[model samples]
Target: MGLAYIFLTSSWWQSAFNFLSLWLLDVPVNAYVTLFIVNGFIAPAILCWLYSFAMLLYEKIKNKILIPSIILFGAYEVLLIILLVFQPSLVGTVGENYIVSRSILTLIFTIVAILIALITGCILSYDALRSTVPEIKWKGRFLLIAFIFLTIGAILDSFSWTAIFLVIFIKIILIISVMSYYLGFFLPAKLADVLIKDIQ
Candidate 1:
């Protein structure tokens, strides 16, 4: 949806402002835009998706802890819709580069939604890490770290493609970490023991 927004809604620029364009003085506008859309918009959207799945899993495993987390994340999703509707950005004439989102309500909702998502996401990850099942418990820790880096990368990467590449490099390492878990799950138990050393 967000990517469609970028391609479908093309507009001329007043000095080409994107989430990262202001800070990144040297990079091309296309790189800046690509990073902003990929990291800033798509990343949070993916988090929303993963969190929803996490809620379902946690509900089965940890119902008591799941309730508040669901509520917060649900509210976060709702506000995210509001943000999408408004489409935050700097757009206007040369002298007056005002915000594209006109309603202050939308702005406030976006900020609040971000805060709710962040806090509850970290909490949920922590609770998941506390599971007594050794496998789940350790995976939970990795997930918590992944979410933290994902969130940071999502926000910071928007400002520059340099940051985006850095984040991607880090996440690639994380992907390898995660693949070992899958290997541990699917491979022959004896082989798994040898092939997949414990990461956490």
Candidate 2:
């Protein structure tokens, strides 16, 4: 995700003012447009699919609705990879671009993939929340909040410059939330028990 943001900032230039600067700098408009489509759009779309897979794995291991989530996630990844490889070229005139005819299809696929990822994330979050274990409750809450922030960030990208900044802020929050959840849930219990026994 950091890689995705770096690509967006350095190559795509998210701000409208930065976009205008391209004209003064003598950079081809199509180049920035292409970078936006490929890195800003497609790469993050692919990451969402990967995230769904990770959630599917967690569900299966934790004995949730394993098979269906895995199958759906796998299908999503396949579709995302296919769309990424066959992306319509933004460098040329719209109708003349390669894969132009398939643009609608790609868009539909991406939307479906995003929806699947969200659904899977919700299921995993719910499972975590419902666990009798205290550690898992905290982990689940973090996951739920992370996904909520991520969704908000994605929506913010469609709004103004301030919204874009909010998106970046939410991304940071999501990352930290997930990291802290894992560290707290996976490490503390066993390590604390070991340390207690050694002290005795």
Candidate 3:
């Protein structure tokens, strides 16, 4: 779990590197391109997380969802690999310096992949909240709550539901997610120990 936590925090490293690249190195990487590269670190972290979710789900339902999860995981790997390999041609708009999906088909595929991941991600979070161990259980709850908000925001954003109220709602959800995610890390040491314990 401790190791998993460290890997989960890999995004922090990506952010740090991106920060340095843009500010200190004066490398004007396109924001989207930088984001694409940064997200590379999340796959492993999320995989560990899905394992946590699938474990709980299996215990409850006796269904072998892990196989599907593993298959989805493989597909995710292939998608990213294909994206990276073909990025020069796959994404890039005229007058744009970095990658952005240039084709409607690619864009559709990207959106579908992301939404599928998000749905499974939420499942993983809910499993965390329901774990038998009390100490780290709230960690899962916090993430669950945050993801609820995030999912709402994402849905709203995806549909171009940009009415003033909806926009504000999304912003509020973003704020809640930020608070909730950080709150999970600030638990009592005993709880932290439970939360950080490896799942395997």
Candidate 4:
């Protein structure tokens, strides 16, 4: 997920890659073209991550919904890739710094991505929260918080914020999201015990 957003948000890297592409192919690269390449990569990576995360949480649960949901979303991911390749215009208009238009395809992509993240977060946090172990419950708390930060940061990032402080604030939220994700999985036992004393 971090990798996906880095490519989406990094104009510096995009500019550098554009320069390199122009130098090599004598073709100018606009933001839309750059996004085309990055989105191709990001789409699958996000889907794979979602699947792995879901599997990690839902492995033992005999839920019939998980497999079908994965398949459905996987098809959506493929459709996104096809649209990106064949009908780039439907996605958005080319712009100097970013896509000039937010078409239905873009909206659908964002919605799907957010939906997957939300579902994963809910499942993981709910499963952990219901665990008998105090440590697991605390981990669920961090995971829930992490996903909230992540969702907010991602949504804010989708907008083109001209204000520097908003950009910085979004990055800070994402950083905290990552930290909370780490703690969710590998929180020190002592720290967990300290924080979760009431539960114990």
Tell me the alpha-carbon RMSD of every candidate: 9.8, 9.1, 7.8, 4.9
Q: Model 3: per-residue lDDT, tens digit, 1-200?
A: 23433443342243355557778888755544544443444455556655655565555642465567567656765776576567644432323322222344334543453465457656766666677876557777776675566555544533333256865676676668656665554557765666667542
Which lDDT tens digits does candidate 1 get at residues 1-200? 22322221122121245435656765434532332332234224434444454555555655555456567556655654554445533211111222122234433433444344456556655675677765555555555554454445334322323344664574464455344333322335564344336543
As a whole number from 0 to 100, the lDDT of residue 135 in candidate 3 is 52
Clashing pairs in 4: none
Candidate with best TM-score? 4
Tens-place lDDT per residue, model 4, 56-166, is 755565246456656766776577667767887666555654433446666567656766676677787898999998899888998888888877876775555656788
What would the per-residue lDDT of candidate 2 be over residues 130-193, giving only the tens digit for each residue?
8876566666676666555445544333222334456467556555644543443454777546
Return the TM-score for each candidate structure.
0.39, 0.44, 0.51, 0.69
- Indicate the residue-level lDDT of 83 in model 4: 72
Model 2 has an lDDT value of: 0.46
As for candidate 2, its clashing pairs are: none
By summed lDDT, the worst window of 10 consecutive residues in model 3 runs over: 92-101
Clashes of each: 1, 0, 2, 0
TM-score for predicted model 2 compared with the true structure = 0.44
Q: Highest lDDT: give the candidate number.
A: 4
In model 1, the clashing pairs are 20-159
